[model samples]
Target: MFELHLRQKSTAFQIEKRCKALAKVIKARRAPPWPCVPTPELPAKVVSDALIECYLRTNETLLRVLHIPSFRRDYEAVWSPDSNPDPTFLVLLKLVLAIGATTYDESFSLRPSAVRWVYEAHTWLSAPDFKHRLGIPSLQANILLLIARQATGVGEDLVWASVGSTLRIAMYMGLHRDPAGLGPSTTTPMVAEMRRRLWNTILEIALESSLNSGGAPLISLDHFDTEPPGNFDDDQLTGAEGEVLVPKPDGTFSQTTTAIALRSMFPQRLAIVKYLNDLSSRGSYAETLKLDTELRAAYKTLTRTLQTCKTPTNGPSDLELRAVDLLLRHYFVALHLPFFAPALKETEFAFSRRVVVESALRLWRAAFPVPLSQLPTIDDPLARVAISGSGYFRTIAVQASIVIAVELTSLMREEESLGLGPVEVRPDLLTALDDFKVWSWKGMETGETNTKGYLVACLVWAQVDAMRKGMVEEEWVMEVVKAAEEAETRCLGLLEEIEARGRQPQDAPFGTATQGVGGDAVVTPDFGVGDWDYMMSDVLFNTAGDPLSWVFQ
Candidate 1:
């Protein structure tokens, strides 16, 4: 039903108008149908439970997308439903409820209707005239919906593309740029600060999408002059007037500035992503070291209270700990982007072996399963910071596993040249592959059409899952050559299955295709997933002479 062509469009002024019109047409087609709902008013208990789940669990862990400390105040006003209704707020409330419902299993009595509640929120969001009301709350609602898709476990991934409208609408409303030039009415310190936070949030989301979507963000520093959000929480300001600085989320002043700690790092990290986007033009290692120093300098310049990522001798506040975790994952993102540089591709291993190994270690710490005593929040047995994550975190897991595996082989090959210590990837690599398979299953069980996990399974030979299948340990770790051959044969079979599916004439799925975030790369009709035509052996085997270092040294 759709063509999946990867074309490079020339930058020219000639087709700007035509491009805009075509975009609108495609977006309109992507819109969901008028969603059905019973009513916006739900019982106070249901509402309370959901908000509690959101703040205590979802907000901190999976969906740290909101200005929670402030949004909580606004959310409280209409949470009981005695006031006049606003459509945007209503959407936010419903999505909050949807994410709340997903925190538990279906056996809970209120869950089925939560499904209806989610669609009801979309109904308000999808209203034709709703575009006219796009503003701060609308942007908030769109981001919440996007986060909830992964948090709730029932929503589809491509459906998350609905935020494409939010990005555009926010741009059209001029939320991307600071409104200082608009008028005095738009220039209040309070309003100025709000614009900064919202704009930065949009930038962060756009940048995140760009990573997997392979598309550049609609927002760039060149187009926007908005300053970074101030460190204050929402209650510090009253209406258009602003005052009252708070150093922490709990209204105490130890040192760490509340809320915007993560936001502050967005620009530097985003620039790194863009810089590494082109494989052909990797700067020299010295250039990377300079960029690395610059990035670390920005990080180090933060106040001591802001350095919560260092595992303080005194325990950190929950908010500070979350910041620590988030910063670590983002650091790996910055560290690994350059590994994708073209120069790395010239060699059998990823471009930068040192950064790859370092990133893999750090990311493993971020997403790796920890003992219960080490977990920041352990309210429920099933809850995990990474469990509710969208594929991004798990994608990191897969990348780390593969990269570490590459390191193992590379070390074995270069043992004579570089006297590197022995490396063992069995446990960490097994864990990473396990995490990947878990997420791939969740993505599918929650209504995924792509059989992505099937592909990841080919990598480790399901070594972890083999125990579940009653296979003895020796069966999986058999001699390397036979394992490689079997992996090749199995991979070919999976590729053939995909090829067969492509050949069949099938109707397009109901909604309009979600355009991928990538503007430069080719995409599958389903979006970023591409044809797995290159054999699995491409990644599975690497050697100096033998060319098949499947096992570690």
Candidate 2:
């Protein structure tokens, strides 16, 4: 039933004959030896479980965004190094091997060696002549290295240096410009196609890193004419004129690939956001609303695979993880669009307070199916992409917690305004906060304790006391609202204090912080957007001046 998952399997019989002749030479003139680092050199013949783990980890996680060329030939080259020893390719292969060892399987007993391999790969890059070897191929190594750092869950900012350099290197290669647009140019079809794939990969990495870390993109969309990758296997693609090939498989994304649907969807969505960012003046409310709709439409258009997952119970299979990854992209769009709303807007604006609350609720609910409490570690499938890099799961949970808490109090106020007796607070609101706490404990394990606790703590307590009304139903008092405000202020103040002390704020609930090595501040998650951003997703409200920001219509 399993079709050809990897091309290497399909062609092994034919390749083995050619490989036998080459292996003799590779065995004689073995790979460039770095004796100091303890990571083992790759063997020229059959790969062990260790290499498979590396390839699996690298392919599953990094290829979520990094779309590189075909692996079969490149991999064969690794086995036949004497035929062509591309150092940059070697560096990329090592990084992939390193990541596999570090992240692919927790049950994988070879973890210590995976960690060693990561260092060995870095040492390979640190060699004195590495600079001289920098070229387009080196871009692939740099990206893989960044991904390895991210996958290790100790994501730091050492990648910023890599990112900044990657943009420049891509520019030098004319990767930002489409070769197809180059009328009268004679660049071969194979080369042009490869450049297109690599460029899109760089953009995904750049956009994700920028948005997640609050860093600016290395290159803007306006500069690039390169197209998203075609929905075909590399074998089907050829340099010959007018050649058509196999289409992307119908159905869901592969757990091991950057799906063609995503490769197509993500770049367009990013382009919309980039356009919004570049606007010199805020667009008219109608214009802004149109843009918001565009983002949501993109989400609706995503072609998701139907993965029937039994989460945290039997755990998600690898296919289920790919399904989760695709849906998370929708969450990213949902959380982002509402960020532009001004809750106090006119009727013309579609991004109302209701839209914000609903979006937050969708995000909160999404975290449940394989919620953090059920998972054993941060490396679990549900936690890996959302938790490790952007701390997006944490951000959505806390943001939703605050918004829902505020909503409960606002409802009571509405009843009082209509001259009716005060209504009781919803039990669901209280339960949601407790659920958030359960989700947050994993983050606390990673040094994110205070921020997660403070989000709905005092607010929920205050609301519950009012709902109980000292065991007697009483009219809602303005003092309840005031108390909630004071508690929020106190929470904000505490988070500010933490930030002042140079520990990342507790306001960024549900995420961990990794101090940069040697005081470098390398891969710290910018999981630090203030909860206030959600209260003003429309971004038109000045929460600073308003007394009851969340209460606005």
Per-residue CA lDDT of candidate 1, range 124-205, in tens?
Answer: 5555554334445555667766656545433444532655676666665565566555555434555555566666666656
Worst 10 residues of 1 by lDDT: 528-537
lDDT of each: 0.47, 0.46
Error of 2 at 239 (Å): 10
Q: Model 1 lDDT vs. the true structure?
A: 0.47
Measured with C-alpha atoms, the lDDT of residue 426 in candidate 1 is 49
As for candidate 1, its clashing pairs are 213-518, 214-518, 215-517, 215-518, 215-519, 344-351
TM-score of candidate 1 to 2 decimals: 0.60
Residue-wise C-alpha lDDT for candidate 2, range 124-206, written one tens digit per residue: 55555533323334556666766666544323445555667776666655667776675423354555555666766677666
- Number of the top TM-score candidate: 1
